[model samples]
Target: MLRQVQKQMSLHSILYNKISENHILKKINYVVDFSFINKLLEDSYCKNFGRPAKEPEMMCKLLFLQHLYILSDEKVIEEANLNLGYMYFLGINPEDELPDKSLLSKFRTQRLEEATLDEIITEIVRQCVEKGIIGGTSVSVDATHIEANTIRKTPERLMKHLARKIIKTYEKENNQVLEEIPEVPKYKEIEDHTEAKAVMKDYLENVISKVKKNIRKDCSESIKTKETIEKAREIIEDPKFLNQKGVRSIIDEDARVGRKSKNQEFYGYKTEFMMTADERIITSVRTADGAYVDGTYADELIEQTLKSGMKIEEVYGDKAYFRKPILNSIEEIKAKAYIPVSESVYRIDESEFSYNKDSDEWECREGNITVKKKYYKIKGKSRPDREGYKYYFEPEQCKRCPKHDECAKKSARKILQIGLNTIEFYEISQYQKTEEYLEKYKKRASIEGKNAELKRFHGLYRARGYGLLSVSMQSKLAAIAVNIKRIAAIAASKFCIFTLNIKIFSQYYKFCLN
Candidate 1:
């Protein structure tokens, strides 16, 4: 039942006074406003049905405490019971009973959806902005992988195990045993794992076909058998059903294989963050399957930040986000992009030729090259226009030049072909050489520190639950915990400064009176 009434206590309760003056939790309680939480999550609950539910605000506070202290659900409840500060933070009286660990799990998985969690995060950020903790003018974006809660296994092994499971289910459902159950093929003698995987795939396919045919012919069939067949078919249809390190995990199908470096790989999901530069507070977060490239969601992240009412004047990222589409999206929002140019841009050295923007011409030491716009055509039909500039050097001028061999490697005319990105690339390259751009670009490093803080302090390096939805919930809560901690620290600092100034003024006034 909802705890709507505050418990009455003695006027001079020792526990109440002690918790009221606690530094960290006290500051957090004052700085964070949880009154809006219940209203925001009002739609998640039924107004007139079922037994009375736990207060949504208190449940959310419990989740915040869980991530803030890096405690499991059971551990968090235990700590809250033992510590007066935690109890006070949650507005629970000393004698009030705590909810069960199972209830906490249900709240996250069943009550709170991803969008609701996102709204909670947005509200926290809005409060921070109102308190002057976040500048909201610039944000840095980056992604990190959280290890999924699953064991890594080869696709061939996983597939064989799945097939065996299906067969077992079919056998258990019907009261009859199969005449022959296909044995898992042993590839121990095969030195090449790839070739062994292919062999197992063929064997499993044959076995699955036989089992399906047998099940279809049977007069008595159960729902379990039908579901098993459907799952088996899904496995067979997957393109990487039999390759090594292809299928992510049997336990958690949503997680995928992500590469951390050229030599290191992990099975998990990627958590992307857009954090404001001033306070290092995360403005928006998106979780994706680990296999997704970091640059693929750059536009979406920026859009989400904008939708959260954070006015972005500039955005910063690494070379991975230096794509044409991403750059254009940032430009469309009229925000300056501080992303570094890709290494490919360095190869196009424009120092040898001077560009005249008005004439759209490139002037060399001895010859002038004019640009011609080119379009694409396929099968004698004009396709959608793909605009690119083709700048060709005078063949006669190049033949007479002293650096002809260095300039032109082929017998054909010296032509440089580039799309519209060439202009953006040149601009970024020039901007990168200036001190202003370098100073602004340095802010992008703060997001790396935020990522490290999450992994090291909040236990975000490894997911606490399986599946994408559970992992995403964990991530959002971790971000909220981090923001709350930051806000508390900032508020405490200001309080200290104000107290010191008041004491100094009182001392000065006493001296003047004396």
Candidate 2:
């Protein structure tokens, strides 16, 4: 089933209510406790009022119900009013009044703050760590884009064709009869199934032209186009608004969009997350701009997570992460970067002295490099790019070489400037010529499956909310939600084992009687 019930907490609800009601405050893992969340918001002005405080235990119960049921505050309040199970879960009687929904919205804006969401995610991660859901050996890393909260568009970003339509409006005198004024304000309710964005592009362009003309006509005697615009036109020129759309919401605008593939487009900021191999628990969540290329982003993600106090033994990812920098980082950590090597390098000079096959003579492609100052040194090139890197070619050898077009470029002798680590990793990566090495490279496929699960099942493909903080909160909840589901499955399997053993006992008893 698609799990579409947004808010209905009846007795028929599959998720139970009495799951997290342990008392006595005894040596519990505070990380998963609702009280921890309460503490996060306790300092806010909402709780500092003269009104009677919600009993601490009752507050914890209400929050726990929200977490498990994935309810918005409004939904939770509604369910508590209608459902006996929900009321009972919150330590309220069948007769007690439900809490108001506005309380939560106000609380988030006035008190809870952005850090509370972050703390909730952190606590979930802490619980996963405590439960051994995360291990250092193998983590599947992937990223997705999310739309920014800004619904901004600018005249400059409009297609050249679209801009022409706007300008031509100015070329003609403005008549009282305008082309088509869209509901003039908001497009949130304007989702026409037949509407193409290209149409919106044209509409916005025309709108831009009228607005500019209005600015000119409305201009004051002092500043021409600047002094007489409305609050709306002033908004049209806000540097943040590259373009404009949507009803005025007090937050930023712009639905950042990106493509995962040909038809699989998503509107969201990209989030790169890593999941552990053993239990499929998310280790970290990283949000990237929708525009960053995946392969290049792999190294940045791996570096962040590794620095965040996790021991990473291996990284698994798809072709999007198969890059030279990613592989080199893996080698630096002595962890395997599971990526398939391209087989285009069909022939390599495997001579005895070439890069010292076994004896380490350190030969150049020509024949051998004479050791200067006991180490290969070059001017200007540094660190990973130094020595064994700046390749010096003999003019005599290169002038007649068959592959000189690619191998050397200079009319004289050519010097190839590259990081030694870069070429060395590329060469070492070539050892996958054998089936044994190819088998090791195959683990990357596992992460692709994990990416599918993270996208489809974990609610990460796109989220319901629009802000960076809101989207981040939803993504973190989703990861922990999946982890909690995994934990529940583990618990259920143990219960099944116990029931199976009992069944066996009963059968054995019946057999003895017969």
In Å, residue 178's CA in model 2 sits off its true spot by 17
lDDT for model 1: 0.78
* Distance from true location, Cα of 200 in model 2, Å: 15
Q: Which candidate is the best by TM-score?
A: 1
Q: Which segments of candidate 2 are over 4 A away from where they belong?
A: 1-33, 45-49, 53-73, 79-97, 132-136, 147-254, 257-267, 292-311, 318-388, 394-417, 431-459, 494-514
Each prediction's TM-score against the native?
A: 0.90, 0.58
Model 2 weakest 10-residue run by lDDT: 22-31
| Lowest lDDT block of 10, candidate 1 | 371-380
**What is the RMSD of candidate 1?**
3.1
Q: What is the C-alpha RMSD of each candidate to the true structure, in Å?
A: 3.1, 10.3
